[model samples]
Target: MAEEKSRDCCVRHKKREPDQYRDMINRLSRIEGQVRGIKRMVENDAYCPDILVQSAAVTAAMKSFNKVLLEDHIRTCVVEDIKADKEGTVDELVRVILKLMK
Candidate 1:
């Protein structure tokens, strides 16, 4: 049942501003590159500590990305939904926040 609900939500979409979209895509691209660098480091037999540092950096970058996206969602999607009388959006946002926390 939970999976079905999640799937239902997946069918909905939001149109983001062009600048916001571009910024998110750019951040993801950088994170992707960082991940690839880390992979190369492993394949090249780099020192454990050095590879760990790069891994930590990628984790931090992903967290930063999530923060920006969450802020934008609250500022736009959540606000819009609430204004439209969609109280369920609050519950959805809470669920998402909890998931992110984990």
Candidate 2:
């Protein structure tokens, strides 16, 4: 018979708290504005270097957002499962880390 999986071992994981979600949404909203601004800059024939700098800022903001979410996941879901010795939890975490690195 196939081995049973832990209850928490699934593709979908726990969600962030409302405050965290809101923070992410706010960051994304700013990024959306930045994207629109980039389009305007292109249309107005703005300096290429300025546009590249703004694009870099947007990328940094997105990476910051991702870091926050990853930290939360490690502190909450991954820690709890690892402490409890949940089946395949460590493996899953390692896989996620590898995927993120790539």
Error of 1 at 49 (Å): 0.7
The C-alpha TM-scores of every prediction are: 0.88, 0.74
lDDT tens digits, residues 1-102, model 2? 133455444446567779888988999999999999999999999999999999999988888877887788889988898899877877887897788777
Instruction: Tell me the spans in candidate 2 whose CA falls farther than 4 Å from its real position.
Output: 1-10
Off by over 4 Å in 1: 1-10
lDDT of 1: 0.94
Poorest 10 consecutive residues of model 1 by lDDT?
9-18
Reference-based lDDT, each prediction:
0.94, 0.84
**Residue 18 CA displacement from its true place in model 2, Å:** 2.1
